[model samples]
Target: MATLIVTLSRLNARRHATAPVAQGSQCRTETIPMPASGDLVANGEEIVELLADADCWVAIGADPDSSLATDGTGTARKLKADVPYTFGIQDGEKVAVEAA
Candidate 1:
């Protein structure tokens, strides 16, 4: 199976925070196996870091559907093996991934 290491870092503090925190003050990480489809929802202003173990396809903010092929077609982006990619995303966005 293909694998993706996803790290999410908050760009700001929670709205109910009693104290101020710097941007990127909080974070979380997860390792996801692909060929299965699912959604990763962000809860706050955040950025995502994706590191793949094998070449794969990722669809952010959209359903993967019948896509996710090795040829790198039909997905929002293609992830190369052993490489790290990062990007900013709005709160409540969903990201999806699968084997390419």
Candidate 2:
């Protein structure tokens, strides 16, 4: 499992909420199960393809050991390792916009 940290402008039922930031945007450090990769990896191509047409733009780093931020929730946050994975999508776009 991979923990994907997401920061949004607001809270929506579509996206799960774990905590909130001062910006009023809800943040969540969720996870995804990509057994193929064997670890948490948010490679631009892979992620973009995985979240096709999603609105939010997430930039995943290659920490391999430590990409997981303290909470991994913000305008720009890296996801943690070893957590369930799930992406929120609505109308062919990522409504859970950590970007849009």
Best candidate (score: lDDT): 1
lDDT of 1 by residue, 1-100 (tens): 7788877777554666875343554777678788554456667746788888988777655444435456756546878899999877666665567676
Q: What local distance difference test score does each model get?
A: 0.68, 0.29
Residue-pair clashes per candidate, as listed?
A: 2, 7
Q: In model 1, what is the error at residue 10, expressed in angstroms?
A: 1.8
Question: What is the lDDT for 24 in model 2?
Answer: 41
TM-score of 1: 0.68
Q: What are the candidates' C-alpha RMSDs?
A: 5.9, 13.8
TM-score of each model, paired residue for residue: 0.68, 0.19
